[model samples]
Target: MRILIIHQYLWSHYKGKIYSELQKIVNTHKNDELLVLQTSLNEITRANLGPVDRSIHQYNYQVLVDDYYENIPNTTRAKKMLYWVRKFKPDVVNISGYYEPAMNTVLFYCRLVGIKVIISVDSTEEDKPNIWWKEAIKRFVVNRAQGFFCYGSKAAEYMLKFGAKPHQILLENNAVDNQKIASIYKEAYQTRETEKAKYGLRPFNFIYTGRLMAIKNVANLLIAFAKLKPQNWGLVILGDGAEGENLRKYVADEQLEGVTFIEGQAWYNVPKFMALGDVFVLPSYSEPWGLVVNEAMVGGMPVIVSNKCGSSHDLVKNGENGYTFNPYDTDELAAIMKKFVDDPDLIKSFGAVSQSIIKKYSPEQVAQEMYDGFKKVMYEHK
Candidate 1:
């Protein structure tokens, strides 16, 4: 099938778990005459932590599009997309996000051509949708697209409120490669054991992996860590961003000795580091569904994620598998960390529960669920 995948905020330097699976399919099907057009360089394009590999087409989408500042806020994006539609004449035009200036522009093109448009949004929050224009545009294009795909059930409900029909919203839960992780866990854990001894492993190591943007609440993490000086916990901040440098400076100024901040590592290396952690935490301001949560869970590390992260709503069993805390409340985050520190048996017990739950998150299984979503949308559209 000829597909035209459009993601305006898709940067070539960015590496996501979705990229690994999609690229495998793209590489296998490149001979099938597939075209994946992508656009990027949104708000947090700085601190590009992409790999420097020359051989791998890590960021190369099947097709490429540019978004300049001058072109934004103008109708030029709509005109360009219309031209692309006519020239490419694809069977499917899948869009990643329906937010920002790109949302209405893509909606207009999809309406004009009567072509299939599939939207995959993170989620909408009751506190703040951020992109209020997106809600209005979604209602306007209620039946314009084939269907809408949400990361979690809560997000699906929110999308329906924006005028997506009951049958139109599908759940494509974010997952990780459990089989791949299982294959390498034994070896990686052994390697990490030796590596940790050499690097001087600290007790109760708390690791956070993801973008260090404002939404991640890295500052809140620092505040919580500061409260745990007498405790055994040490914060290991992984991933890079604009807030990364500032955060490093803040750590030094605050004289945070227990914290060790490593620059962001590549996507493939993340799982290994997660294996070394005693506990993993993600205090996202409002993440649709952080895929890294599954990565950590598969790595057998208990996670303390914010309630805003869409995955936390489903992946976290609230004290059974892992803990959940409010992003805005550092005290709550600190308390969760303290629980893990105070009890070593909790790690072994909860870690077992976490890993058992991760078995179902295999890539093969997730791919089937995603394919089901695709078929459902296509059949309903017909």
Candidate 2:
């Protein structure tokens, strides 16, 4: 099946879950080109970091775009897309948005020409559009899409407020590349021990990989780490964001001597980091869905995420695979982290369970669900 995807903000450093998953499936399918018509903005959401004006494929580019419609906000981008449509003649048109200004109009026009749409949603309570206009973009445009794929049930709940039917919504998780990353870690560990030892991290380390933003509540993590620093379990902060300086100040003020904040590293280095961590924690105040949760699960570490995170609903099974703590309660995070480190038996059992649970979130499974939904949509709408 020929599929044309409309995902604005394609990054050079790392591709988003949908595009990466689709590419993997398309490669296997052989007949599919998966014509991707994406646009990206040169905007920065972080407070730090000077601009790097290289080609589209340089630096750890910010994947988040402030202008949902990518600044074009007019017919120009839509008109240009038609040119691609004529050449590709995609059987499926997956608009990676719903509430952006010109996005719905573009999808409606595609339908006028006979392409079926499978619009994916990026909605989250933490990242919802401003309450103004009563969320018209979602209520009017999203409800009518052929199919809606999202992170999970939390997204389905939000889409329902927008008048979308439950059946039309399929859960598409922001998952980790299980096979690729794990193999890299395995190879890296077999060759190098000095690299990890240089950072004061021993074999039994705990890691956190993500942006250092306010909502992420890495400060909460530092507090939790303070409770467990006596146990010899080192803490590593992986990604960088606006809250970096504030977090550093807080760490110093708290006198968290053992906690180490390593700025954003290469995305490919994730497995190696994950290998270092005996347990993983994401103490987000209100994360819609964290991709790092998937990484931790696949890497054989017992994960601890906030109940506020959307993915925690599916990913964490409490004592079975991992723990989901209330974000407001630092004590809960501390308890889980201590358990992960103190009891190796529990870690092994939970890690095994996490590995089994990760199968449901694979890219191939999600892509097939998307393809089947597209065919069903065509059968009904045609």
Candidate 3:
């Protein structure tokens, strides 16, 4: 069997890890082959994370464009994609998104050629406002695909709303490199005290790692943090974006102390900073899938994510692993944050549950599921 995966960019270390594992699995099969076609090296919004590190992306892959993905012309992308699709003649083609006009072309071509198409779905219903025409168009595009690889339960549900059958749902566990992150966290955990001292972080901290955009609800996180009475806890906001200066000013104006802002680091290096905090929080009004929550869970840290995040549906076990609150409610968010401040023991207890729950979403596990999905699609198509 020959499987071709068309991904948007090579910057996602999590996808790289999944592809690497899938390649190994395919290699074990006598005549199985896998090829990944990346659209670009990175996206413009993530240029600050630096170029793609080849060391982390060790798999059979090709980049169609060396420039940022947003800058790539639709014609060029479609032409290149068709060129590769025709040359490789894959038994199955898995596309990362259907919203791209180029992908729509490829989907039609693959369908005409009798090649099974699998779509990778990450968009949840809550991520954006729904429009009648847009949803109708999406249904048209979604119905053309033979199978789907969903990010989580929410994503699978979204696909169902667009006409994808339950049996057609192939893989749903979207994940990061659990072993890699666990290793990094273990190393960081050893010198946790020393690292905190180096950065002057509080004994206990609630960390938010992502772009400081309005949709991320960073301002709301700050407001919630401000509500916390003076304690040994602090709010560590990592990553930089347009809202950085304004957020910093808000902190100054409110006289909010113990709030440290660190510029975003490379994807791999994010786990190292995760060591500085005891709890992880993501207050995003709109998030398709919060992979950072996976990173945090793998690092054995309790997570307080917004209910709006896709990951919260599958990963967060309500009071067991951590809590999920509405992003728009500052009081609810603050109340959850105060739980950690009022009782630090919840951090370790909840974090342990998080680690156990995350084991099901490891890269290796997801890769096997993807491989199984490929075989199932091929068999049904035959």
Best by lDDT: 3
TM-score of 3: 0.98
- Expressed as tens digits, the lDDT of each residue in 1-382 for candidate 2 is 7777766655422334445555666677677666666555433442223232234232122222344334554566666666666777878787767755556776877768877777777566555345757587557777567778787767777777777777777655655566766677677666446767777765566788888888888888888888877556678888898799998898888877767778776566767766766678888888777777877787766888888888888888998988888888888888888886677677778888888898788765776677667656756656
Write out the backbone clash pairs for model 1. 8-39, 36-63, 215-285
TM-score of each prediction = 0.81, 0.83, 0.98
Report the CA-based lDDT of candidate 2 relative to the real structure: 0.70
CA deviation > 4 Å runs, candidate 1 = 9-35, 40-47, 52-61, 66-84, 100-103, 126-134, 176-186, 249-254
Better of 1 and 2 by TM-score: 2
User: In candidate 1, what are the lDDT values of residues 1-382, reduced to their tens digit?
Assistant: 4555665544332223344455555456444233455443332343254533333334345323345333354355555555666778866676766654555567657667676677776765643655767566656665566777676777777777867787777655666556555556656787876766655667668889887888789999899988877456677888887698889889889888778767776655776777667788899888878878887888777888899888888788888888988899999998888887878678878888888886776655554454455557545666
Ranking by lDDT: 3, 2, 1
Which digits, one per residue and each the tens of the lDDT, describe model 3 over residues 175-244?
Answer: 9989889998889789889978888888899999999889999999999999985479988999999999
Residue pairs in collision within model 2: none
Pairing residues by index, what is the TM-score of model 2? 0.83
- Order of candidate numbers by TM-score, starting with the best: 3, 2, 1
Per-model tally of clashing residue pairs: 3, 0, 0
Better of 1 and 3 by lDDT: 3
